[model samples]
Target: MTLQPKNMLNRLLKSLLVSFVCIIVLSIIINLTAIKLPILTEASYERYLILFLYLIVMIFYVSLLFDQLYLSQKAKGISLFFYLFIMTGSLQLLESLVAQINVQPKAIVDVIVYTLVITSFTVLIFRYYGKGAESYTKRIKNYFSHQHISKWLLKCIYAIFLLFIAHYLINSMLTPFIEPYYNGRYTNILKMSHHAGDVKYVSMLTHALVMVVGFQPLFALWKGSKTSLLFWFGFPLFIILAFQPFIFNVHWPLGFRFPLFIEETLIMYIHAIILVHLFYVPDETHKEEELVKSKLSLSNW
Candidate 1:
């Protein structure tokens, strides 16, 4: 509820400004050190322009989340810090692992520097001057309480598998459209088409877990309905995940971007919808009623 179209300027501008300032610091670091990320393409003015726009959009996405979760809801700074760090860091590390990109310690350090810069700025500025997490506390206490330990594990496993299926299904269905765009442009591309033991699943597993962590605070703290969560939370997330990579690698035709966007965003929104549903644990009033519904089920048998 705190993040409305009219009032989003408060959150969006601050985050972008902070990220931009931090990016300058990061650019300086790259200039000074051997630290580099794995972008195989040479830079051009047009490519740099695209990169610039992508970074803006990416920063806006992150800031939107920061506003909804921490600034508007008053979640803890530690939560924000860890969310930003782990989400971005895990993405870098996992991509390096799965894509088999030859990432070095310097690349990791690059991620760390940017993560810290953005996290510290948001925590200091927003936590200090913002409305605070009164809503976060009230919403969480009102929403969920006791849950079965077994149910927690089941929820995680159930969500991860289903999320992976959604991701795989989308990519597989769209590959016909996307493969044409591959164009033999970049041999250094990801060959993660669905296979028996593709490493992409590993990335999906990590994504599912990270998504769960990210979802919890929002579900508990956000004052919006599931639809708002989908738009505010899910849409922005998928946008960044879908488009951020296109920022660096300029070899592939822009043709793939749309289909790939469809694939990534489609799966991600499904992910958010699933999380929203999965997290809808029974309150105390229905806890007993909701449990053990089937007489011929495994438990009864």
Candidate 2:
């Protein structure tokens, strides 16, 4: 959270190295289990091009994850496990389910194993390359911070509404460009009701809640450093949702998926900055300063 630009670059490169090693190990595991994943085996010009961008995006994501988890707050062992297997895990599971194509038990296990290996290496990279950094100087609070239950619920409702609007409006605008690629397959662009029908609303509800309860550590980062906001929040969400379609789908044209990537990443960034403003706890010093100024004005009056 408090890194110099050069150190940030260093951490990114180191984390990328760790991630590549993890990917190698994961590839061996998948091969041993005899699970053929298109993401690994298939290569095309478009695929490789997107894959290269994905790696660039992931290196920063991993590095930022380290800073947000460690320098932003105290990252306990239990908390690290929760973020890896539970917080981030939920988002991954949702996207993976959406990406399924005749998934077998082995494929499911491969996904779980891949998650384990990559997240585990993320921790190792943090320990060796980033463990002792100074904590962020700002007082940060997120949805998990103490608040009246009713107010917390209001924030959740507001977030859900915002997300729906953002997604609906963005998809509406991009539908023409994106619909060409759908090719009679579920003519609707957003696909909100694709397989789940109305049940997808429940899924969206869970997605909102996941942001509330699972991403407290990230709320501060969302409000910091405008130059990096796209990668800090948007890129990770975009990459997760795009990985299967943009990089792995041999038949799906890149032109189709690229718009979704832009759509989701834009929404994610907007959501992050907005939520941080609406619900996050105020900085302690900033809060005190406001209090003092208010009292001084009252006394003068």
Candidate 3:
């Protein structure tokens, strides 16, 4: 799908507006309930605002990626809900893990409440937009038909596994050096598997698998355009931006902070760019289909 500059700009603006509105409404509700959310409570207003802006951009990019998939309107709407649900769920799960280590009652309560809120919204939104349970299932089946799932797409599953292994190894080595400097305060990587015997490896594996699988649709959508200069540049930038949230969470010493930020950002970006270029390629089936259609038209003439 061709992304028009004008249309992309409009979508970006709309995403930003929508995100700002949603966060404001959610913050109001949280305030009224007097529930303490992690960053919302402890973080400065400027920091929160920066996160909101980043979230707006992230959502916009994700929506653009979703649009490229060419799903039905109903399906697209459901996809957004699914995205929000999964993203929030994952963050809350991480927060829960941290709470387990620090024993924060409020953080635990926030996770429960946040899960309920997201789950309720997801159910309500899906019910409103969905035709019926059977129809919904059928819609999903239709979307994931033979045309979309080709050999190239299947290959991404293996690539994702390998990427996760790389991420695990890199994180394992780098985190120890960083954790000591921060005194185990900012880095969740260090805390995730702290005392949890097999739990650490399991959690790391689970998170990597979930993220890779969750992002497969986008990977499949973009696979055909892997060679585009736009993809080459934008993909790495996107990876860097993805790590901003994590970097911002870390409480680094002033001298070490900027360098660490640059270092992690570069590492994540390089890792993603290299992996995508190495493994993801255009689907042969799709190329064949286009060639067949072209030939058929020429023969008719």
Per-residue CA lDDT of model 3 for 1-301, tens digit only, reads 4668996777777766655665665577677987765547554777668657765665566555554555556655656555554455553354234222333546556655644443343333223332322344544444355455665466556656665566556655555444454455645433444465465455555655555566445444443455452464344344323354354454435444444444445434554564555444355645665567669989999
TM-score of each: 0.71, 0.67, 0.60
Candidate 1 stretches with Cα past 4 Å from truth are: 2-13, 37-52, 70-76, 92-106, 127-144, 178-185, 190-196, 255-258, 280-301
Which regions of candidate 3 fall more than 4 Å away from where they truly are? 1-5, 34-36, 42-44, 91-161, 182-197, 219-224, 227-241, 246-301
RMSD in angstroms between candidate 2 and the native structure over all alpha carbons: 6.2
Per-model C-alpha lDDT, please? Answer: 0.60, 0.55, 0.51
For candidate 1, the per-residue lDDT at 72 reads: 44
RMSD per prediction, one decimal? 6.6, 6.2, 7.9
Colliding pairs, model 2? none
Note the clash tally of each candidate.
2, 0, 0
Global Cα lDDT for candidate 1: 0.60
What does the lDDT come to for candidate 2?
A: 0.55
Across residues 152-234, which tens digit of lDDT does each residue of candidate 1 receive?
77877888788778866776788687565344444455443445146767776787677776567666665544456667766
Model 1 TM-score on a 0 to 1 scale: 0.71
lDDT value, candidate 3, whole model: 0.51
Q: Could you tell me how far off, in angstroms, the CA of residue 186 lies in candidate 3 after the best superposition?
A: 7.4
Give the poorly placed runs of model 2, Cα more than 4 Å off: 1-9, 34-38, 41-53, 71-89, 92-108, 128-146, 180-200, 220-231, 242-250, 285-301
Q: Which candidate, 2 or 3, has the higher lDDT?
A: 2
Question: Which candidate number maximizes TM-score?
Answer: 1
